[model samples]
Target: MTLAFTCKKCDTRNIYKISRVAYYQGIVICTCSGCQSRHLIADNKGLLDFPEFGRNIEDYMESQGESVQRLVLSNTGVSTQDSSTRLSPDDSGNES
Candidate 1:
């Protein structure tokens, strides 16, 4: 539940708990009036406001052994001149 704001101009990050005004709403301006100058450079958002991406808990449960098999196949493919092995990063922070 950490509330944070990225200065749109300078990219300076700010964190807040509460404010006198309601400027902390989604995609709204930072409390600091000076931040307005950076409006085009950064976005103010709470960490939770960012989109949830990639695999989820269900995917993890399904992928356990299959994912490792993919890696082994990919390693074998890499030895070939043209490997059709293109994989994306997984939720565990490794190549899939």
Candidate 2:
């Protein structure tokens, strides 16, 4: 099955099949490292929950060294910016 992961912060979200761990799994970080306001304000216990479909960020954070945090944060920022730009204004409100 395909799985999706989204950051509680910035917005970098991605999808991968169950077996894609080596290359495509959603790596989670537990040190409250997400780059979004949501993540910054979120409790550690709940950070992984709102993203809904991600692997346990803490597992990867705990196991991996600190080398990848920058990369992850970059991706998250891109995702958040891209998502905000693509949002569709509710048609119920008005179409412009």
Candidate 3:
């Protein structure tokens, strides 16, 4: 099976090949193809590790007329929009 996730550093989507090794390892560590940043894959709590991953898979399967099981990942209704709008440390606090 293939697992997908977004790179936190570069904001790039990545796909990892899940294999027997992952099961044996308990926790799989993956490096981002885009930014080369490392990330952990947990044996459990995959939904938390990759919140949008399952949803992406669901969309693809539906497009192909395949039935897929839904996984509820997120519990917190926290908004990402506010975080995205925050100014970087280097910002001069000016909006243009």
RMSD of 2: 14.6
TM-score pick, better of 1 and 2: 1
lDDT of 3 at 25: 39
lDDT measured at residue 11 in model 1 versus the true structure, 0 to 100: 71
Report the candidate with higher TM-score, 2 versus 3: 3
The Cα local distance difference test for each model comes to 0.36, 0.37, 0.56
Using Cα atoms with residue i matched to residue i, what is each candidate's TM-score against the true structure?
0.23, 0.21, 0.40
Best by lDDT: 3
Better of 1 and 2 by lDDT: 2
Count residue pairs with overlapping backbones in model 2: 2
State in Å the error of residue 93, model 2: 22
lDDT of 2 by residue, 29-82 (tens): 223235532222112344344554334433344455422221112422322323
TM-score of 2: 0.21
Residue 13's lDDT in candidate 1? 73
Candidate 3 structure quality by residue, lDDT tens digits, 1-96: 456777769999998776745534355668899999876554343534564333344443566686644222234422234343333434566667
RMSD of each: 16.7, 14.6, 15.5
TM-score of 3: 0.40
Show pairs that collide, candidate 2.
10-36, 28-57
